[model samples]
Target: MDSKLNRSVIDISICSRSISDQNSSETGKESHEKKFLDKNFTTKRHLKSRHIQLIAIGGSIGTGLFVTIATGLIKGGAAGLLIATVFWTCVMLLLTSAVGEMVVQYPAPSPFVEMAGRCIDEAVECAAGWNFFLMEALYIPFEITAVSSIIDFWRDDYSAAIPISIIIALYTAINVFNVKYFGESEFWLSIGKLILCVGLLFFTLITMCGGNPAHDAFGFRYFKIDPFGSGYVTTGGLGKFEGWLGALFQANFFVVGPEYISMIANEAHYPVRKNLSTCFKTVIWRLCLFYIGGALSVGILIAYNNPTLVAANTAGESSAAASPYVIAMENLNIKVLPDIVNAIILLSALSAGNSYFFCSSRQLYSLSKRGFAPAFFQICTSSGVPIFCILVVIAFACLSFMELGTGGSLTALTYITSICTKSQMLNYLYMGVTYIAFYHACKAQGIDKSTYAYRSWFQPYSAYIVTFFLLVLCGVQGYTVFLPGWWSVEDFIFYYIMIFVNVAIYIFWKVIKRTPFRKSSEVDLVSGLKEIEEYEYEHFKIAEEAQINSDTDSEDYKKKNAKEIFNNVKTWIF
Candidate 1:
């Protein structure tokens, strides 16, 4: 092993020297400018602070929280689900802090994937980029399928094909326009979802307090009935453990992709720091209000033994009926509210699908920028849309039509959901590991953490903790397959294929490229800093000049007040 490792090191050293010598032919200033231009080629900076702030909320709260937590409730029970959610929320918060620190310092199209190259190895970056790209691509269909399922809650008479096609077309058009359009659409959609979530929380509290016509105060009724769930696949301590695992997996799915915000940071307008800080802050609140609070409310409102939940769980469906909000309303004979909740679920699904298309296209564009994909994907229109990448990603929307085939949308959704969960788990594990590498690299390079734009508390310790748990969770997320009489070949493959694909990609690239992980001291943290520093300096300079101009121009006083009024309104809405 040591001999092979040494050989790998020598190979990478030789490759690095070859590349360095090739670049030595260029003038230093020319090389620096070319590197900066090349890194940002084709992508435009059109996303404003408001776009990013709202994206942070829109990206994290999705159909999983709105619809799929029912599966967690059925499998993990109320207490187990809540505990798992809180635990994973803490884990996600740590991850957000770690990733946020890196992104604020060096915002890139695919922030974590790019960081993986610098912090780990080029091979890992290649693997991580493609892995993330595929994950996002597959998620497109998953969200679209979610839309179909939610529609099913209303009327099973119409085929899903019509709505799926319409949704694909609508979001595809939105994405093809420009980043601003996508961001604005997501912002409003997210606001709608947030309002719905808040409304549901209030309604749950009221129903629990006997606000319904049935006058049945359901406060703690479900919790008292069944706290740990109907036993995972059996009836004992092992089942309770399994239930906890199920809840952990559900929570994982709910908040898997907050890193999407960092990815958008690359295209955001200047003042990335403020946007990132606001994004992280809002993410914390969203998780608390939407995920943890929603989970608790669901547990209190609906028993795990509810037939609707059992049917939804058995079918692996994410429909409105499966939603605790809808189920709770149904218990109170509140017919009108269920339809409203269903509409909200539909909006949540559509919003998530929109984001999936946006994220997947950007991931492909990032891969192209990094040389992991064909350069053609790097092509952009005058409007700064990655037209080719968008086209390629939208092409995958055709997979949504597979729902019309054997086993139907539910089967496809189950399969896609399983793949997406595992793929995202791999991404999270990579993030944790990358942060550790970054933390150590900072020390090795004599860079002070105190100087970081967004320093996360707990340093390398948080990285270690998050990384450890991610590893354990990923390893055991599919333990249900091993339960007696529960083994199924399809189930095992759906759950583990992403892990296998991730490993295969990494090993394939490592062997073909002979890429060796860099030593902590050798990691290049300075390459992108020059451009970022220049941008930051120029941004603040412009802001200062604007302030001075505003102060000096007496005639502009009314204009400034008017602008301030508009700004206040914008702040309130966003």
Candidate 2:
């Protein structure tokens, strides 16, 4: 084992040296500006493997799973909603696999945008960067609105402004302090959410088995009675189809942003194959347990035609009253559980808001670094906080206050949520397309995909499939607005505005810059790959030296495992 490990280290060192030599011979001079090996100017690598895992779990499981699943149940009934959620969970897993391949090789802040510039076109990078930034910015208010609504469960007398202000202030402080502060906060918050989700699932099972005060087991009762819902705007086949589409869109919201995990990976302490592969491996389970399982549980617990569900839908309220979980517990006369769930829901919203601030700020910082935004946005504090970018994103959180007015907050939340959903879909579409470009670029460059550190399963084929599906989903997401006599100009604009905005940005930049699609052979993978190889090789050298030194000290070496000693040495150097 020792001999094999030593040989592996030697091989990596040789490969690193070869790449460095080739790059030096071709460029004549190394490009320091392109190298991200420095710690001072780059974002700090303070996020650990655990931090990234929780980020993936927390970012994917948001207010949508807890509150918005009710909307899907109302539209598509239990069976339809469950089917849609399961199908989309599979879609998201494919998307995550594609992204993990690229991110593992070239982890960077806002990786998708950076990859677009390298493997596709600069215009694509610009468009994707701004689209994602705007999407995350708008989502801040969406989560803030959720927080306000969750607070309604406790007190209706207080103004929404009070809680909104407190949440905005708290998350902003967390972001402005340091990257580890944000990661640690998110790690614990995600744990809270995970605990709540597991508890909910367990409680759901007990409720279904007649453990409730009512003693009325609801074992697939809703599913057997009414599998399909009564229709959305119209009444027959077309309406049911529309309802199915609505549920599909809601599912998209639940799992739309796992790419955020990759974005956060850029700051991870070990942004290499092991860290990323572990993160992606957990994605399938998260999809099953948190998304698909959550949807199925909601369907089992709450009937589609329940009076509370109808009233909640008609009122268009975002409070705990609108949540099917609360409604189900109320029906079972489970008094304390509803309040407890409502509080957990509040924390979920706050955790999501924290994530929104982190992602949007980093998006701006990445854009600034790429020269697509003002240079001031590139400035980071001594502790590696992007202070200016965080402030800009926090300023947008003020949009939450629009709720204090006469129906103004809900109106704003409606438009913003629609726009956000469309924008997030665009991000997913770009990720799929970008991964395809990366795969082709690798092949064109004569790099063997099979030997890559983190190879995706279906490769170019999966990318192609996900890309096509995302394109279709983006176009048809607003199909309900086109139903005869159901056209509301407001609804139409809200649903489709981001699509137009994305295309307009792409075309405007393309025509001005004449940025054409990059040829696969000409893609610039060498610069980033050199930096990554150099960093990895140095770590390998350190580990090898540490092992050799430890072997000489037989007494100490016998007391500790080889892996443990190596890890301790690596931690010290890192």
Q: Which one wins on TM-score?
A: 1
lDDT tens digits by residue: candidate 1, 331-381: 778978899888987888888778878888999998888888898788777
Candidate-wise lDDT, in order = 0.81, 0.81
Which 10 residues in a row give candidate 2 its minimum summed lDDT? 32-41
Cα shift from native, residue 27, model 1 (Å): 24
Q: Give the C-alpha lDDT of model 1.
A: 0.81
Q: Which stretches of candidate 1 lie over 4 Å from their true place?
A: 1-41, 408-413, 551-574
How many angstroms is residue 557 displaced in model 1 relative to the true structure, after the best TM-score fit?
5.2
- In terms of lDDT, model 2 sits at 0.81
lDDT of 2 by residue, 201-306 (tens): 9999999999999898878888874676888767798778778778888898886645777778668775465777777776556657778778899899888889
